[model samples]
Target: MKRTRRRKFPPCGRVGKWASKHSRSGKHMKTKTGKKYWLFHALSILLILMLVALMCLNRGNPDFQNYSNFYWDKDDFLKRQHEMGFFWLTRLGRLLNLTYEQFYTAITGLGLFSLIAWFYRYSKYPALALAFYMVFPFLLDIVQLRNFLVMGIALWAFSLLMEAKEEPTYRYLSLSLLLLAGTIHNTAFIYIPFWLVLQWPSIWVILSSGLAFTVSLLIPRFLTEASLAQSSSHVLQRYAYLFRGQVSLPGRIFFISLSLALCLAVYFIQYSLDQDRLLEAGVKPKAFQSLSQLAKKLSYLSFGLMPLFFQSVDFFRIFRNFLPLYWLLFSIYFLVPLKAQHKRLEKLVLSLFLLGILCVTCYVLLIFSNTDNVIRTVFKENILLRLIELRGQ
Candidate 1:
């Protein structure tokens, strides 16, 4: 009988209003996210354009002169380098009747585009990844055109592998890309082992990394030994020649400490994930776990191989190779999750971490500025203005 008036209760009305509000907020959030995605790409394209202009117009640099020779003297190019991929690309450019500037622009643009595209698709913070790139390897890569191209291909392959780790098609494609990259630069072959190491169990990964570190510690001793220098293997001799330079004790310590700090940050992120801290912050546990695991593996690999930094400044490239992944980890784990949790201690840690990165960036800038002719070449008058002046002349 009382069914005559199932009253429209205030609570039910309030619940309906709350549900509507929540839905509207969710839609707003999605719209915001979509805008952010496009904005990121727009900025990325601008950055690529800026970098390409800077690199292509930097004609006075020693590296530029050396690379220019590759376009004119095929025989000398082939004789000086075993890698044939860039040579073939030059041939293609010649067939197209492209000038050296056009060819260099195409190659540099393609490489930078691939790297930035990968970051946009996979990284939680593409901007941060780009920032990391700028602070560490951008200066070096701008000059080392071939290596930069190889790095792009290698990273693209890595992105594919990560996307579909178990898919045979992706594996083959990634392998092919890597092989192509190796043809461009033999150092790309180094990633094959790194890729394999990523698939190991955590315990095995740790043990292998420890073993690598131990072996790396002995590298200094091996370098000093006469037998290594006298070895018949050309590869050993080449590496020995490359690794001949010694880093100062303080410099070595600083690099080792930086590596350790990265590894520790990864460990802390992983620990937080294990404790479900991120899950409590509304993160998808599975995705974050996968990322944390990947980050941990990469960090371990970096830590294991870090002693090479002590052997040669060139070894900095090795660490730089891994920086994109590190930035990805830091963005997703340390930046997003920690910030979302709104905990004071986590915020403090984030601030400290950022400060450390700023300091490291300054140090890198100091080193880069001190590099022979970098400031003169990089900070010179704008290339566009210089071209206008030349035309006016």
Candidate 2:
């Protein structure tokens, strides 16, 4: 028998490329993955730029005046923050000379970038993460600049804590970020609790969230009727504001029927997938466990608080924080394929899946378009055109 010459394979890295190019390999799959990642980053940068542009173009808002006055008419920055209680952002403004229109605009820009980065870091589907970031919170940031900025910092801090694993120094650094967020925005305290209990499973998350919902309903009445510490009443007053506003009956019905129940279902489906993957890997996935728990809690809480949204549409400002959890589940729902016994049934399911995405994309577009009540918005002509002109100048 003639001995054939044996070819020595190159390194493992090269082997993948060779196999991909020559055989039934993942050349197409890898390319698709790379494109998806590229799209994610591109969209993220675009949205951040849009946010900066909005801040720059819409400088006539009253808050912009306050920011500028803090710089020009300021006797002492510390005195102002003491009176206002936004110490962290005050320090940021003073340190960076961020009271300037351009400077604070830049700060908002950086905050948006960091916020998206935090979400994208752990997100299984970066596109979905970016989409949710754009749709709900991005607009709110334009108006509630300081509030969103503080929350954005906390969100970045949460990401740090999630990524830290058990490293003591990293955990401390994460806590420092959380502290910074709390100092700037008091609502940051709401999020700090989740970090302590990040390891809770879905069942516990559901139960705790339900308990929280019941507590939320009762606390407002208790705070109103009972005498309490000045600090306690002041804190509880935040929840007291929840029952003051009422959404239209039809709108409430629509949200409950079409949006809330579907969102909760998506979350449960994602949790099931998480369980299955954990079993398959058969190894500890400490990774993203904390985040998954957070998502589950937030989603369950959002469902629990659906009645509150009926009370006040503005509740969305608070509820929007939970929408990130919805987006995580939303992405997982689309990306993960369910096991099917029949291959043809899977194909039919694929068509239905694409149709569902189309329907959702249309609904979101329509919802944003029906901005009759919105005074300022993303669709205005000035964002890109003026952004380009300003950059050119």
Candidate 3:
């Protein structure tokens, strides 16, 4: 009877073995994941093509303008433009006797390849991320902006820095990359605070101060005098208009209140998180608690909101540039407590969030499209005409 006995395998084990064998045979079918991967890639390619077409069709158009020419147009940008390290690159490339086509090809090729590499390395949905990058206004117009290549480098450096905390080598690489980026264009300076936030808090103030000092010294030399003259005039007028701008009393109050509430919420959340960490670490929580308390007190700073006289206010402009506020808002949404703990409820919440993001993105594209069209019309009607008029004058 024992010799005649046959061993039976469990159904689950049989399926597991079968599936494993099937996978090894290269006919492994993950219907869901495969479909998603293909779809993501297709969408990415489509988006990139659409963006390229859009840029190409409008390249000569005035709305898009010729921002790339800023570096080469000596009379227009002059000494001021040199402060941007890009001018140095352009000069070096020229000095090397490289043809214009050769230099351009090299820069654009590197920028694009780097971006593709970034997506491949970092994105869970690489295809979707690539699609986002293609259509983003910053990227779409980047090739036309001489500094955009450098900006891309800077952004990539920042992205690397985001993940480089544990790896000291990468941190140094990021610093070097950022320094190069700053040389190419100083806009990387805007992100220094965020970078500092990811670093040791003890050194944050000193590092920031040093960065500021470095920029103050290096930026002035390459300052595009031409652009600066224009930027200053525009900035000043914009400020004046913002501050003096007429706003409905209700609208003004609503936005100001909203801004204040948002800032306070962010400060409190951050403070709470810090306090929680300190408590968990079994450190003397009193000092940490006191600091958190101060942050909460300072959260009341929002109450000092002055009227947006005409919208040109420097304070308002500065406030408008505070992109970190959105990060806080996004964090709050994720932190929302759900009454129901059902799997279905969790799925529903995730789906709704994704849908909302899609809707918002569509709306933004529609707005940008409208603006692009308007810019095209204005450029067609008067860009050359304006130039002629200026010459006549």
Score candidate 1 by lDDT.
0.67
Q: Which runs in model 3 stand beyond 4 Å of their true positions?
A: 1-29, 51-58, 61-71, 76-84, 92-106, 138-147, 201-351, 354-370, 373-393
Estimate the Cα RMSD of every predicted model relative to the unseen true structure. 4.8, 7.2, 12.0
Query: Between the candidate structures 2 and 3, which one is better when assessed by TM-score?
Result: 2
If ranked by TM-score, best first, what sequence of candidates would result? 1, 2, 3
Across 274-321, the per-residue lDDT of candidate 2 in tens digits comes to: 445432222134544555555555556565666556666655445454
Worst 10 residues of 2 by lDDT: 276-285
Q: How many backbone collisions does model 1 have? A: 0
Full candidate order by lDDT, most accurate first: 1, 2, 3
Better of 1 and 2 by TM-score: 1
lDDT of each: 0.67, 0.56, 0.45
- Score residue 342 of candidate 1 by CA lDDT: 56
Count of clashing residue pairs in every prediction:
0, 1, 21
What lDDT is obtained when candidate 3 is compared to the true structure?
0.45
Q: Local error of candidate 1 at 374, Å?
A: 2.0
